[model samples]
Target chain A: SAVISQKPSRDICQRGTSLTIQCQVDSQVTMMFWYRQQPGQSLTLIATANQGSEATYESGFVIDKFPISRPNLTFSTLTVSNMSPEDSSIYLCSVAGTSRVSNEQFFGPGTRLTVL
Target chain B: QQQVKQSPQSLIVQKGGISIINCAYENTAFDYFPWYQQFPGKGPALLIAIRPDVSEKKEGRFTISFNKSAKQFSLHIMDSQPGDSATYFCAASTGLGANNLFFGTGTRLTVIP
Candidate 1:
């Protein structure tokens, strides 16, 4: 399985501020996805961070709110811009491939964000 | 709309008993169904998965039973243990451009000794 790590394992941000979360994988991957897990809620797909193109946001998510950058195949970042109280959630980064024990995707530990 | 519905918001099972979690999907385009296990302060890990081509798939103590015609699938955990207590999620995804998985609400499983 790929070894994935995220910076700022946990953070407390004030409303109207922006916090960027970085995801780094030990090896190159073809697909990297960002997900959000709200308090006591299921995991929600935020966007698909493409290596060279604009990130593809989900239906209820917008690029302005969650901008993503994937400079290389092994690294990506998600910036929660203009954060709000409702934006408090655990943000996770995942990679898709066959390198893992399972055919499914492998995820990072996750970045815990709490907006006050 | 692609939505995977899961059942049993919470469950309590005794150790050495069987724990079952069911999930249903409305979209037939979903060809891949995967179950994930998540512990507190951790990301969800892929537990097991099954495809439409097979009716059931088993991995050690965990099994995934799929009903293609019914668009429903269930996870069975045998010989449940205290260490198996965690929140489980069922997700479905299509083989479209990108693998965008739609997840269910999740079921909190508590295995008591």
Candidate 2:
């Protein structure tokens, strides 16, 4: 298991503002992912942050709206640009273990963003 | 299409009783299945996991039963306790290295003392 932490545990942002959430892991990891959890909903994969490469995003999400950067193995960031009330959700980061068979993931304490 | 489906959005189990949560997946490529537990104001934590090769895996009081032919799996918690009350999520992943998890809707389990 890995120790993961996210900055700005929470924040309240205006509708037009932007906020970047930072995720840091104690040890180096192979894969890092960003997720969004709406109120009373399941977790949605926002993107997969690749070290030294552009993040791979899933459908219903885009790079222009949710830009991501992963400079190294243990660090990544997700920036929600031009936020809106509908953008209010808990943003979480996770790191996948190196094991090929198991490959479990450890998550960071999410960043709760309340867009008003 | 929804990749993963979960049942019993909420559950109430008496202490020391059995707590069961079921999940099914549509993608046969998904080889990894994991159960995550989340408390209020925190991120989800990996509780237990299973691979396709195994029919069942037990860790202490928690057990995961996998039926590969049915494309389904379930989590069984023996001797439930109040501390076990939390939102449980079942997730599946293909060859994406477990980074891209297709999470189920989640089950809110309330174990009463």
Candidate 3:
């Protein structure tokens, strides 16, 4: 299991503003992912942040809206660009387990964003 | 396409009762099925998981029942407690590709005293 932490645990931003959430893991991880959970809704994968490479966005999500950066194996960031009221949600970062012994992925505390 | 679907948008169970949340997936390629529990103002934690090869898996008070033929799975919480009240999600992944997971709509469970 990995210990993941995110900065700015909660924030309130105005519409049209952008917020960048940072995720840092205690140790190097093979996989890092970003997910969004809308109000009262399930989580949706925003992208897969590969170390030293461009993040892969999921369908219905584009880089323009959610730009990601994974500069190293233990850290990544997701910036919600041109934010809107609908974009207010909880953003979480997760890392895949190192070995196949357990496919369990550990998650960060999450950043709660509220756009007004 | 949304590969996974979950039922019971919300559930209310008395203390010491049983709470069950169901989910179904369309992609047969999904080899790993996991359930996550999230408390208020907190990120989700991996609760329990099962593979297609097994029908059921248990850990503590949580249990997962997998049905390969129906392409469905469920999480059963035994001896529900007030602390167990939280949002639960079911997710599936192929474990081969990029390891991206498809999540089902969450089920909010309220364990009443």
Candidate 4:
């Protein structure tokens, strides 16, 4: 199992300001992902953090708003730009399991962002 | 399109009773089904997972019942306790690993003593 940690357990930011959340893993991983959990909602995949290239974003998410950078296998950062009230949510980073059959993903203790 | 569909937006179960949450997927390409448990102010943790090759997988009090033909799966929590109260999410993904997941809406469970 992979151990994951996120910076800033909670943050209150002003609207229009950007907040970057960092994620660190215990070891090298192949797949890293960013997700957002809104109030009383499910987890929505933001993008797949590729090690050397641009992230693969989901349908509704875009790079300009939620930029992601995976400099290496164990570290990645997500920046929430031009924040608004709607962007106030928990941002989490996850890593997929090494075993193919196990196919599990471990999530970091998300960063709760509250936009004021 | 919603790839995964989950039922019972919320559940209330008595202590020592069974709490069941169901999910169905429309994409046949999905092979990995995992259930995650999330407490307030915390990220979701993988509770139990099962592949399509197995019909059922259990870990302690948590069991994952998968029906490949029906494209559905359910999580069963037996002998529910107050500590089990939290939001549960069902997710699916393709391939072995390295793929993004499609998550269900999630179910809030309250286990009353």
Cα lDDT for residue A62, candidate 2? 98
Writing each residue's lDDT as its tens digit, candidate 1 over A2-98 gives: 8899998999999999999999999988889999999999989999999999999988999999999999999999999999999999999999863
Give the winner by TM-score: 2
Candidate 2 lDDT over residue span B28-83, tens digit each: 98988999999999999999999999999999999999999999999999999999
**DockQ (model 2, Cα):** 0.69
lDDT of model 1 at position B21: 99
lDDT per residue as tens, model 3, B1-113: 66899988899999999999999998899999989999999999988888899999999999999999999999999999999999999999886533877888899999999
Q: What's the lDDT for residue B32 in model 4? A: 86
Give all candidates' CA lDDT scores: 0.92, 0.93, 0.90, 0.92
On DockQ, the stronger of 3 and 4 is 4
Candidate number with the higher lDDT (3 or 4) = 4
| Candidate ordering by lDDT (highest first) | 2, 1, 4, 3
As a whole number from 0 to 100, the lDDT of residue B2 in candidate 3 is 67
Among these predictions, the greatest lDDT belongs to: 2
Q: Interface RMSDs of all predictions?
A: 2.6, 1.8, 2.1, 1.4
Better-scoring candidate (DockQ), 1 or 3: 3
Those runs of model 4 whose alpha carbons end farther than 4 Å from true positions after fitting are A99-102
lDDT of 3 by residue, A1-116 (tens): 78899998999999999999999999988889999988777888899998888998988899999999999889999999999999999999999855564466778999999999
Best by DockQ: 4
Model 4 TM: 0.96
lDDT of 3 at A24: 96
